[model samples]
Target: MADASHTSYLPPILIFCAGAVIAVPLFRRLGQSAVLGYLAAGIAIGPSVLALVNDPDAIRGTAEIGVVLLLFLVGLELQPSRLYSMRKDILGAGLAQMALSATAIGLVGWKFGLSVGGAIAVGLALALSATSIALQVLEERGDGSETYGRRTFSILLFQDISIAPALALLPLLATTGAQNHSGAPALAGLGLALLAVALLVLVGRYLLNPFFRILASTGAKDVMTAAALLIVLGAAMLMERVGLSMAMGAFLAGVLLADSHFRHELEADIEPFRGVLLGLFFMAVGMSLDLQLVFDNALLLALAAPLLVAFKIVVAATILRVSCSSSTEAIRAGALLSPAGEFAFVLLPLGAALGLLNTQQAALATSLAALSMLIGPVAAKLIDLWLSRRAGPAETMEEDFEGAGGSVMVIGFGRFGQVVTQALLLQHIPVTIIDSNVERIRSASKFGFRIYYGDGTRLDVLRAAGAGKAKIICICIDNREAALRIVEMARAEFPSARLHVRAYDRVHAIELMKADVDFQMRETFESALGFGRVTLESLGLSYDEASLVIDSVRDRDAQRMEIQYHEGIAAGIQKVPRVSPEPLVQPKAKSKALTEETREVIEDGGAEVAVGGVGEPER
Candidate 1:
C-alpha cells in the first residue's frame, strides 16, 4: 500500500552513506581531502546508476542545513574587534578586491550577452573564493595562522558580510525588473540592517556575555551548545525576516558573542556538527551532479569553470601583490584562493529572484560554483608543489638559525603565553619568542621582551629559534592549526626537546593527544572552573563536600578517558600500522588465515560480550 516514490528514495541514502564510509579512508590515505572523496562517491552512485534522490527540493532543503552550519562557524570567527584590528586588509585590500573583481567580471558577463543585472550578479558570484576550502587548505599547509592566513581571512570576512545586502537587493531588483528597479526597498533593507546592528550592540554590550557567564556557572556543556545554536538560529531568522540573508544575521550574532568566556567552548561544541553537516551538504551537491548536462555542454562547462577561477586568482593576487612585496607571496595568495565559495550558492536563489538569472542559468551557475569548489583543492596542491620546487629544499635555510642563544623557544606571546614567559623570565631563563604579529612584536620589543617576527610552525623558523638546542619548546599559539603544525614539526625534527603546549580547551586537548602531544594543558581547562565553583561553595562552609565532589569527578573522568583512548588507539593500530622501516605489506598466508578467522568469529558471535574482565549479555 506504500507509495512507489517513497520506496524509490531510500536506496540513494544507503548508497551515499556506504560510499562515503568506504571512499573516505582510501582518499585520506592518499593525503586527499574527504570533500573530494565525497564528490567522487556521489558521482559514482548518482542517478545514472541508482537514482537515489530525485526530489531536488527535498535534497536542497536537507543540504541547506550544511550551509547554515558553515556560515554559523564563519560568523563565530568574525568578531568586530578582530575586523577592527585588520582594517587595512579588510577595508582596504578586501574592499578593493571585491569592487575590482565585480567590475571586471561584470564586463566579461556583459560581453557574453547577459543583461546588466545578470552581469553584475555573475560578476559578484565569480569574485567570491571559497573561504571554507581556503581556510582548510591553509591549515593543511601549516600557513593558516601565518600572515597570509590572517590577510586572506580578513578579505573573506568582508565578502561574507557584503553578501547580505547583495542578496537582499537581488530579490528586489528581480521583482521590479533590473532596468526599472527602485532604490527605496534597498534603503529599507539598509534601515533594517542598521536596526539589527543597534539591537545587537545593546544586547552584546549588556546581556550576551552576562547571560553566557550565568550559563557557564551551571557547568553544563550541552546547555552551552544549545544556547550557542539558539543565538545563531535566532539571528539568522531575524535577518531572514528583514529581507536580509541568514548568513549576515548569524555572523552578527557571532561577532556579538566573540569576546565571551564561553566563545571557545561554544566553538568546540559546534565544530564537529558543522563539519559533518558541511560534508553532507557537499555530498548532496555531488548527488545533484548532472553528468548529462556536462556531456551536452562539455566544452562550455570546461572553459567557464577554469576561466572563472583564474579570473578570481588574478584579481585577488593583484590586490595582494600591492599589499605584500614578494612575488612568491602574491602567487601563493592567488593560487590558494581561486575558487567560488558557499556565497555563490547563497547568491543563486537571490539572482533567480532578482531576474538576473533564469532557472537554467541559475542551475548552470550553481553547477559551475560546485565544479570550482571541487577542483580548488587540486589547484592549491599544484601551487604548493610549484612553490616547493621554486624555493628549493626548505632545509637549506638552516643558516638562518645562527646567533640563537636562547635555551627555550616560545611560539606565541598571547595572553596565556605572556604570563608563562614572564614567570620563566622571573627565574632568569633564556627564552626567545617567535610570533608573526608585527604590532605585537613591536610593542613587546618596546617592553623589552625577547620576541621575533616569524611563524613558529614553519620548520625554518623553528630552527632559527635553535629548536634543537632548546631544552623546552612551549607552543602557546591560540589557533588550532598552528598548534598542530608545531607539534608535527617538533615530533619530526626536535624529538629530544620537551614539548609543552597550551590547548584551547578539553576537546582541543583530545585532538592534540591524537597528534602525539602528550604534555598538553588546556588554556582554560575545567580545573579553574571547578575551583571557582568549589571556592564559592566553600564560602558557605561546604568546603570539604565541594572539594571531594570536584576531585571525584575529575579523577573518574580522567581514568575513564585514558582507558578509552588507549583502547581505541590499540584497535586502530591493529588495522593500520604506522610508518616502519619495512614495507607495510601483508603476507598471503596470514591474510587468508585472518579472513577465515574473522568469518568464523562472525558466524559464532552469539552468546556474550566481555570488557575489562567483565562478562555481559551481547545485547
Candidate 2:
C-alpha cells in the first residue's frame, strides 16, 4: 500500500516540473523578474494547491544549500585587493546601518512588551537587508563599479562574514538567555574561526591552485566540477561541526579559490545548478507564506511592511551620506539599498529556532521581507526617472567652433573606423575617436586605440569632439536608432561638414538619401560576399566565375537596392496626395499684391492659406 501511494504521487511532481519549464520563456518575455515567477509557481503547486512537496522542512533544507552556494560564489568574485580597497565603505556604512537599525528595532520591540534579549535578537534579524536583491538591482543598472556599487558591496560583505558569528551567538542568546559565552569554550570557538582563516590562507597560497592544475590536466570536465562541489560542501560540513554557519565554510572555500585561474571555469560549471537552486529557494519562501496568519493580522502586517523597509533605507542612506557623499550620489545610494533582501528569510527561521522569536514575530518579519523584495524594481525605476528629469533639455543650437588644427575627429571606431584612424595615424591625422560602451573603452585603451567616451547624439558632445570645423565627420554608430538621431543632430548643427554614414540595410540607404545627406555605404554586405568569392576560388571554381558571382551579388545589393528605394518612394507618393486640391492663384503681375493681402490677413492672426506644390495636379 505504501509503495502504491508513492507511485500515485509521481504524476503531479512531473506536472510541476513541466510548469517550471513553461514558466522560464513566459517570464522572460513579460519582463517580469524570474523571482516572481518562481514564487507564483510554488504557490500554485504548494500544499494549499497541488501539494507537490508536502514536507516544508525538506524543501527548506534543499534551499538552505542554495544560499550556501550563493555566498560561496559571491566571495569568489571579491579579490583581496578589491576588498581591501573597499574597506572604508564596507566597514563604515555597513556597521553604521547594522548598529543603528538594530538599536531602533530593539527599542521598538521592547516597546511592544518583548523581553530585552528577545527584542534585541528580533531587532538584529530586522536590521540586515537582503543582499541578493541589492546585488541584482545593481547588476541591472551597469553601475556595479560605481561609488554606490562599491559601498553597497562592502556592507554586504561584512554582513555575509558576520552572519556566522551571529548564528553561533544566537543560540546562547536565545536558549540560555545570555549574550556572551563563558571563558574557555567561547575562546575555543573564536580561536577555531581564526585558525580556520589562517589555514585557508596558508593552503590557498601554497597548494589549492597547484592541486586544481593537476586535476585540469586530467582533462576530465566532471572531475573539476566534482572537486569544486566537494570543496564547498566539505568546508560547509566542517564549519557546521565547529558550531559555525555553512555560509562561513562555503565563503572560506571561495576565498581560497579567489586567486585561482580555474575560478571562472568553476563558476561557469556551477552556474546552471545555482540558478535552479535559487529558484527552489524562492519557491520555498512562497511555500512558507501562511495565508491564515496574514489575514488574521492584516493591520499589523500592513503597519510592519513599509516600516521595516523604510528603516533599512533610512539607516543605509544616512551611513552612505556620512561615509561616501555627494548629495546626488547619497540619494542614489539610499534609493538603491532601500529594498530588504533574501537574508531576512534565512534569518527568520534561525532566530525562531534559537528561541529569539515567536511564531507571530517571525511571520510578521517574513511578510515585510517579501514586500521589500517586491518593491526593488519600483524603487530603481524611480531613481532612473529622477536622473532623467534632472538632465539638461535637448540642445537645438549650433555648437561653438574652435579651430581643428591639431584635432582629428573620428566619428565611429568600429572595424572600419579603426582602419580609417590607423591610416590617418600613419600619415599623422592626429585623431580622436568617440565610443559609448565603458567596457569597450577600457579594452580599446589596452590595445592603444585613442577613444573618447560620449553618446554622439548630443550637440554638446559633438562640439567637444570638434564637429563644427572638422575636415570630415564619419558616422559609424552601428545602432540604427542612434545613427539616425546623430544624423539629425549633425545636419542641424554642422551643415558645412562632409558627412559619411554606415547604412544598415537597403531601406536605411533610402532613408539617408531622402534626408539629402548623401555619402553612405552599407557596412558589411559587399565584404562578406567578397569572402564567398575567395572561398569559391579555393573550391576549384574559375577566377572569372568567382568574379562574376561576386559582381552579381554586389550589383544586386548596391545598384538594384537603389532602384527599389526610389520605386518604393514613388509608390508611396502615388498612394497619398502631396497637396490638397484647393488653390487660389494669380499671375506674376498680381502675385506680390495677393501675397501682401494674405500677409495682412495673417497679421490679424488668421490661419494661413494652403497652396498646391509639385505633386498636386495643375490648378
TM-score to native of every candidate shown:
0.63, 0.60
Cα-based lDDT for every prediction: 0.70, 0.66
Estimate the TM-score for candidate 1.
0.63
* Candidate that would win on TM-score: 1
lDDT of 1 by residue, 1-619 (tens): 3788788777766776787888777877877777777777766666644665556786666566667777778877765545666788888878998899889877987897777788788878878877777776776566766677777787888888787667766666565664566867767776877797688668877898889889889988899888988888888788778777777777777777665646655765675566567667677777666777767777988998888777777778788888873667766777667877777877876787666888777777778877887777677677778788988754311123446648888889988889889989999988878877666777788988757766786565677668888888899989875686578668756878877888775455655666666477666545453554456465652444344334434454455446555676333322221211111122123222233433443345311122122362210
Angstrom error of the Cα, residue 271, model 1: value is 2.7
**Cα-lDDT of candidate 2:** 0.66
Clashing pairs in 2: 130-341
Error of 1 at 510 (Å): 34
Task: Report how far residue 589 has shifted in candidate 1, in Å.
Answer: 83
Off by over 4 Å in 2: 1-32, 48-50, 175-202, 386-619
Error of 2 at 229 (Å): 0.7
RMSD values, in order shown: 23.1, 23.3
